[model samples]
Target: MSKSESAVLDTRESKELKTPTDLARKGVVEIAEELKHLLADTFVLYIKTKNFHWHMSGPHFRDYHLLLDEHADQIFEITDEIAERARKIGETTLHSIADIAHFQRLKDNSEAFVAPKDMLSELHSDNMQLVKFMRETHEITSKHNDVATTSLLENWIDQAERRAWFLFETLRAH
Candidate 1:
């Protein structure tokens, strides 16, 4: 290589080239840990929502089924986003039922179908938990100067909180 080229390479190497992931190493680690929790909680919540969507019974079955299905779909999308974010930061997400059970705030319901109000309560609680985790992750991302991830997290938190509020109101109304 020419002397000028070598000098340029040396200068570049000396400068700290940071990507969002690189800048977020510390926050990324914290967020990864939170993602592990959120992944489990959200995934379990997704399954429960799907169950309610499929097996919802009563006068409001159609409306509840469709609505719950929509919520489940949304949660599934967030699940993928959370996993992708974890992968971006070089972290492995929770990957199995057992892992999910260990980490998730939400619980699996296998024995019997629950009442619509009960289902809504469960979903509301899970969504609130997710909101809390996302808010913390947002703060971490802000500190790390990871604007993109922070923005994404803000959106996620907003959506989750909205879902929680909707569910909460539904329960109160019914």
Candidate 2:
């Protein structure tokens, strides 16, 4: 396809609310909105996880850094799925970095220094919060009868829970 034609088609797709993949319109609308928030949360957490991975220090620096990196990768991996699911249902996915910042419920950490324990603790809390969002998304998807999304969210929750568990155990006092 020509570049202009592709651009035009993209514009049309963005405006469309109907597709062969249609679900109940109302249900899809509601599900898509919640998914956007979930996507925002996921994006924020992914960045924070990477931040912690980069800034981590102290006794268990290597282990903590690697853990955060792995967690960040897992978190980043799901963002596409969340966004694509929205598009599949005839909704526009998150459009830009600002959109993620605007919709995200998670807080960012920009301090120059954070102790290893503090980093672990903060990431743990944020991840737990994400799982809460995932569970809520699960309900929204289920209510909307979007089994594909519901299934994906369940997997997300599991990954989040595992990350949270690792952080929790790592924080435990010896």
Candidate 3:
């Protein structure tokens, strides 16, 4: 990079972006931090869902595989919205995989062979946890009078609930 561009990048890193919002600076910071953690957890859950989808096997392999693929896609679709919400409020977000590892509350599965049933159960639990996290974040947004974020989170919470419901019903059917 050129010297001027490098200097600009350094300045940007050191300074908070000035977004014109009615929220107090402290409130904005708090909201951004909460969103960052939520984003990290979302990314972790998305990867785990994908992992299960790719590794799914058994007599019902096709159905389980497709279900997880849909779940993973749904989980991934919100990540960008979370990050962008943080940015819209004049705050920085997670910068790398290291940041995600640091802030993520959900655990990753690295086992070589997770059973299909186990995968469904684990993802169900994770989605439920995500709903809890989103609700907590919603409280913060509401406190800050961030209606936009709260609205977005409401949709996300519903989606997570649906994913959990699907997993639960699938488990019950087997």
Candidate 4:
């Protein structure tokens, strides 16, 4: 697409939503904010998981690397879904690490080579945090009668919790 075309499209969409947009029902504003933060958190988590996958060492390297890769993909998918949800609610999705870093609740790993156990711990923490956030998002959406977003949040919470439990158990078993 041409740059001008894209700009015009963006402007048109913004204009369309400028007229008293729907407030996501039942305090969905809170849910949207939580999802935005969660998306940002997931973005950081996604990059961290990929980094761990690349730098993982030790005896269970193969297993840990593969698991990290899969987890990273899952985190990316969730981030995309959350961004789409933000768009649905008449909010623009935040782009770039800088934007995410400013608003994300997740921690950044700057100059540390994380051990396998530490990687697992980090993923576990993020997963659990997102699950908690999603649960609250789901509750708010349910109250607002947004069954679709509520259902999606419920499923996401379940999956993230499962992934966290698996990682925790793996570390414990070793």
Candidate 5:
């Protein structure tokens, strides 16, 4: 095939899939993009949480380790839902770790060691940021009248907030 013909075929193949939703195409695209970014951030956060969980040490070793493991599990659980929601809304989901790296807003930690309190503080900040991102995406979903996505985000937001609260309380007790 000629280059131009191949380009046309590629464009056609890359078109967004049709999904049943009341939202306009533009709104669906916007929400999907937001979900993509949120999913990327969640992935980054989950890894960082696991890193802390694995490296935790000190007088409260067991407690901090277990706490981060629970938080990591919660963070990892939402990733599938976020990606599936994007697919359900007629958009392709992230395909690889490079895509996650491109979309992620959270920073990855590579420190040799982080103090236990520092780990809790950093996690608390990241969880709060995730909550903020969810709220922003929730606004977009609400504006588009995408009730299902909005509902899912509401639950995820609550979970993120709970995680943040636990981190905050743990730090406070330290």
Candidate 6:
């Protein structure tokens, strides 16, 4: 190669790669883009959970805060894996908080004094909504035979469902 061509190549992080799996490149790209949207929603949910965790108060402060903290950590764990999945499929992943905000379907709560029950109810609803999104994304992964992602999503779905379940029981009337 010529000197000019060599310098141009050096500027790149990595060369374009040929995906080794039988999965179609076009389909992988499509799936990864959708995953980006999922990642955004996940981020929003994580932040909301953490917000509730930090602001928790009243009689059940200890239990509620700990629950939210655990669930928030679980939600945060999914973000990096989803972003890496996008990269592994040769697609660009989300870059900034603005990018996540743009794609996130969940609402952010910045109020100073939401009731504990209200917080639980909101997070319960959001976790269930996430289960819906995860199921939809699973369809794409299943269609493309992305076994690794599909398997990981199964675990995530269960975690989200469990969070919703716990919150639902917590919010029940006597």
Which candidate number has the best lDDT? Answer: 3
Question: Which candidate model has the greater lDDT, 1 or 2?
Answer: 2
Instruction: Please give, for residues 4-86, the per-residue lDDT of candidate 5 as tens digits.
Output: 77765776787746555667999999999999999999999999999999999999999999999999999999999999999
- In the range 56-157, model 4's lDDT, one tens digit per residue, is 999999999898888888778877788877677656667776779877887877646788898889888888887877777787777777676788888788
The lDDT for every candidate, in the order shown, is 0.78, 0.88, 0.93, 0.78, 0.92, 0.88
Q: Which whole-number lDDT from 0 to 100 does residue 31 have in model 5? A: 96
- Candidate 3, residue 167: Cα displacement in angstroms equals 0.3
TM-score of each: 0.79, 0.89, 0.91, 0.82, 0.89, 0.87
Give the CA lDDT, 0 to 100, for residue 99 in model 6: 96
**Candidate 3 clash pair list:** none
- C-alpha-based local distance difference test score of model 2: 0.88
Per-residue C-alpha lDDT of model 3 across residues 1-174, encoded as one tens digit per residue? 999777658767878565556788999999999998999999999999999989999999999999999999999999999988988887889999999999999999999999899999999999999999999999999999999999999999999999999999999999
Q: After superposition, how far is residue 13 of candidate 2 from its true place, in Å?
A: 8.6
Which lDDT value does model 3 have at 139?
A: 99
Pairs with backbone N, CA or C atoms under 3 Å apart (clashes), candidate 5: none
lDDT value for candidate 5? 0.92
The alpha-carbon lDDT assigned to residue 63 of candidate 3 equals 93
- Higher lDDT: candidate 4 or 5? 5
Best by TM-score: 3
lDDT of 6 at 167: 95
* Poorly placed runs, candidate 5 (over 4 Å): 1-17
Q: Which stretches of candidate 3 lie over 4 Å from their true place?
A: 1-16
